[model samples]
Target: MNRRHFLKTGILGAGTILLGNTLSWAGEIKRDVPIFGPDTKTVGGKKHTPFIKAPKKVKAGEWFDVEVEVGHYHPHPNTKKHFIESISLWIDKLEVASAKFKPVQGAPKARFTIRINKPGKATLRAFGYCNIHGLWVSFPTEIEVV
Candidate 1:
């Protein structure tokens, strides 16, 4: 079998496969993919967030897009007072841009435009925030740019 087969059978689910394929989850921080190292979680322990994702292996100077959405994972759902404070997108270590969303009945949507400015490798992360619960969280989305 090849990589696809290995990934399909070797892991239990999406998150598990992600953790096993990428950076080790045994540390304080972890990324679901390899090329990128451990990701930063909390900004100051007052905000919640997650990382965005895009084509990791793309041609230099090519254009791409990354979309991220965040919502309450709790079975009861969060109260209306809770909402996403901001969403940030980055290429490598540069802070490309950020966005804010108002409280809604459903999940929050954030979009990011990306172009392989240089080449080689890249990483994307999304951060979410909820004021009511006062919690912060992060999830990493990975890709490749040829």
Candidate 2:
């Protein structure tokens, strides 16, 4: 091969190798994105008490009540209401329903009647959020309904 052709081929081969390495490295590594910051405060980080509880075990084919009550302590001074922004209820890997409520006496109540059709262990998870002290905070509580 001529000297000029050899140089051209060498340059092209090096470029291809560089590009391949870069693409492979990018595909092999994953970077995690933070949803909440390090100092992110939840609705009931400390002062805000999550007044919700549920059973971890229950009998199958039985109807049970799963609920969560929240109170916004030290609410924003200018805000009119300190309420849960949203409530997500899930049972047995399925989204059964959703609920919403504003605290009437510093305790907002969200209640749901869960009926178990099959005889097995089920999981009930609830996610809640509210504005406390002018900052948006999330409250997550879960209970088991058998």
User: What TM value does model 1 have?
Assistant: 0.53
- Residue 79 lDDT, candidate 2, scale 0-100: 33
lDDT of each: 0.48, 0.43
User: What RMSD does each model have against the real structure?
Assistant: 13.2, 17.7
Q: Provide the TM-score for each candidate, comma-separated.
A: 0.53, 0.46
Model 1: lowest-lDDT 10 consecutive positions: 33-42
Clashing pairs in 2: none
> Please, what are the lDDT tens digits per residue for candidate 1 over residues 1-146?
88644643443244333433243332333333222112232232212335344555677777777876554232213356646655556565555767776556545657777676665566666545444332233455555656
**CA lDDT of 144 in candidate 2?**
41
TM-score of 2: 0.46
Best by lDDT: 1
lDDT of 1: 0.48
